[model samples]
Target: MLQLNGCAAGSSSLRLAKDIAENNRGARVLVACVELTIVAFRGPEEDYLHTLVGQASFGDGAGAVIVGADAGVHYPAERPLFEMVSASQTVVPGTDHVLTMRITEAGLDGHILRRELVPVAAENVERCLSDAFGQLGVGVEWNDLFWTVHPGLRAILDHIDKALRLEPGKLAASRTVLREYGNMLGATIIFVLDEQRRRMEEDGEGGEWGVMMGFGPGFTIETMVLHATSNLRKK
Candidate 1:
């Protein structure tokens, strides 16, 4: 049982599960994440704005996905949705103070340098993604691929959209999840993926290639390149 306590927990699990499945030929890994942010709620007090923002955005949620190699080899009933093509993580230097959570006498307490968060992510994301794609020996245009971004804050999504110059509706799933469920910390990314899948099926939107991004403490960025499995099956 691996325990990760941060917004990147779900992304971390997906990367680890893929590695485990690749190593063990016939093994299947279950990646599950649950967050109970409400349990850490604090009543209004000093730093009232912090309390208010946290209460307004954070919520309880759980999500799970099964990972394995050789689709339909053992479980013919199992159908794959997204294929984990590649995963990488990068931490912006000297950003330890940006987003942090700690256990306090009252409950969970966290700090976010809100103004700096969006800029840090926007400035570094292109470089980070370029490296990931470069290693795969491919050149990619931002608008040609789908995106599943961690919607930790509306501003983060807005800035990333502008930075990447992504087409409209590229982040619709992320926005929808945030609107419907707020930020459920680590579980939020999984919810975004599910919503993305639904939109692709319902609207026949998105390309065969995609990227999943998650941000958390340390100003970390977890990136996973994805391929639509349905496209592969059709070939």
Candidate 2:
């Protein structure tokens, strides 16, 4: 059982799995995640909006994933649920003060979420994704892959959409999950993936290529590409 923190943990989980595959080929690892964001609300301080952002937009939940050098062992090699292709992460150059969740007298508390966050994130979003694709020697059209992004905020998603010029509906899954469940903090992206999995099982939709991305404190950005394999049982 490995634990990860921050809202970006969803993406980081995949990154960690990739690490295991690299060092111990054929070995497997599972990334389990959950968040009790409500616990951090109204802690030692009282900011209604921030607390509402935590309470109204976040809830408690847990999720997990198993990754390894090959999918054959779990599902037929021909069509495993997901094949992790590549991943990358970047830390904002000098914007540490922008977003923070700190440990203080009352446990954990989110500091003031700055107004510059969206603009700054918008400026860096493309470069971050481009950096990931470039590292993997893959050329990507935003419309070419299924997107599973962190549903941080409607405005943040808007800023990302406008900045990346993504196909208008590319982020629907993320937004849908947000509307249905608010933000489950670190567990949100996994819930988004679960949604994709169920969709694939029921409708054989969402194409072959998938892109997973998330942002967390320290203004860290994470990205990954997953290719779907058809399982006769579902697809």
Candidate 3:
């Protein structure tokens, strides 16, 4: 058990899982991410539109996954709940001013919901995604990967979709989560990842290519490409 907590902490968890799997034999790790953002930002001052947008879109969520070194034996639950290909984080040159949160007597206060956040997020996401895909060593395009983006804001998600020109509804999981659950900060990505697994299970779909993205303070952009452990359909 290890703690990787932050706005894009989900990406950190995946990176650790990848390192453990590749370096240590028989290593198993349980990564749990939980967010209580609503409570974290509770206060009347949150009435400002800057805070209101986030409050309206986020909710409490927690999720976990177990990762182990590959061996012959396997669980019979069809396939792994999720597989992480790679995770990487990037902080654009000097965009840190665009997104940030601070603690004050009024409780946790945030400076997000800025107009600049959407563009900065969209830009960094592209750069990070391109770099992540390069790590996969696969001839895959961004459009080929399933997206499980942390739904930071509806507008930001839309901006990414439009900026990347992703296929229509590619960010559905994030959008759906935002519509129903809002944003859970670092824990939001875990919920999106779980939602992807659930969708695949219900649809009887099996494909490895996936890209998970999360944006947070430091104007950071975190991304991971997901791969199937086995030929899911072949399994």
Considering every candidate listed, which one attains the maximal TM-score?
1
Candidate 2 — worst ten consecutive residues by lDDT sum? 43-52
- Model 1, runs deviating above 4 Å: 1-4, 45-49, 231-235
TM-score of each: 0.93, 0.86, 0.82
Clashing pairs in 2: 57-183
lDDT of each: 0.86, 0.75, 0.71
lDDT of 1 at 62: 98
Q: For model 2, what is the C-alpha lDDT against the true structure?
A: 0.75
> In candidate 2, which residue ranges exceed 4 Å CA deviation?
1-4, 41-53, 73-79, 112-114, 232-235
Q: Write the per-residue lDDT of candidate 1 for residues 1-235, one digit (tens) a residue.
A: 5443478788888999999998998888989899988887767776544767777678899999999988889888888899998999899999989888777665677788988988998899899889889999878899988889889889989999999998888999999999999899999999999998887887677588889999888888999999888733233
lDDT for residue 195 in candidate 3, whole number 0-100: 74
